[model samples]
Target: MEIKEHIIQGVRIAELHSDNMLLGSVEEAVDLLGNMYYNQADAMVLYTEHIADAFFDLKTKVAGEILQKFSNYRMKLAIVGDFKQVSSKSLQDFIRESNKGRLIYFAETLEEALAQLVR
Candidate 1:
């Protein structure tokens, strides 16, 4: 896992780049938060493609659980990538709701995610 930090509009966002699936468990979520916190990042940006499929499966509830961790720790999370490939209406709805919030967002690109952070 490689974490690159970017400061956009005065907010520090850590962009996580990893070949491994980053969201396999709640423990992994904690680790991610740790990394971001250690880096003094105000927010985290993850490419959707780096996440595991299990994270999005509603039955598993990994997505909610992981996101809750971020919320609990008072960290912002931005997921970026082409979400059109994911064909779940419920997931789409969940993303929509999440995007409405200040802490969590689903964006099409890193630039878009950074834009949301500035807002």
Candidate 2:
């Protein structure tokens, strides 16, 4: 995993570039955020390629559980990539609802994701 840290709008964002799946459960979310905190990053940004499929599968409940963990920690999370690839209406709705929030965002590109997170 290659973590690139950036300061945007006074927030420290850790962007992860990983060839393998990094998050799959609430436990993993904790571990991941622990790494971010160790790096002095306030938030995390993950690309679609780095995320596991379970995160997008509403039936798995991984998305809600993990995102809730992030919310509990008061840390921001952003998924940047091609969201159009997901065909589930429920998942799309979930993404849409999440985008309305300040903490979690689903964006098509890293730039747009950063923009939402910085705001």
Candidate 3:
């Protein structure tokens, strides 16, 4: 994985880029968090395509576990994706609720994700 740094208003945000699934389990999520924390990142932007498909399935609890770690660390996260194409109402609702807060957001573009992260 490659992390591209973005500093906005003195906040350091790490934008993750990967060719493979970067978050497949809780352990991987924690590992990612550790890496970001080590880099002194206040927030992160990730593309949905780089995350495991199971993360979008509410039954898997992957999203909850991963997001909770970010919340615990007071680190913001923004996921860039075409969420409108998702068929699961539960996942859609989850994304909707997440977007209503400052800690996490589901955005459609890199600009949108960065904007949300800086907010």
TM-score of each: 0.93, 0.95, 0.96
Misplaced by over 4 Å in model 2 are none
Estimate, for each residue in 1-119, the C-alpha lDDT of model 1 and write its tens digit: 89888888799988888878886789999998897788899998988778888888878999889989999998998899888777999999998998899999999988899888778
Tens digits of per-residue lDDT, candidate 2, 50-117, equal 77788888899988899988999888988988888778999999999999998999999888888888
Candidate RMSDs in order? 1.1, 1.0, 0.9
The lowest-lDDT stretch of 10 consecutive residues in candidate 3 is 21-30
lDDT of the structure predicted as candidate 2: 0.88
Which residue pairs of candidate 1 clash? none
Angstrom error at residue 47, model 2:
1.0
List model 3 lDDT by residue over 24-63, tens digit each.
7889988999999999999999898899988899998989
Reference-based lDDT, each prediction:
0.87, 0.88, 0.91
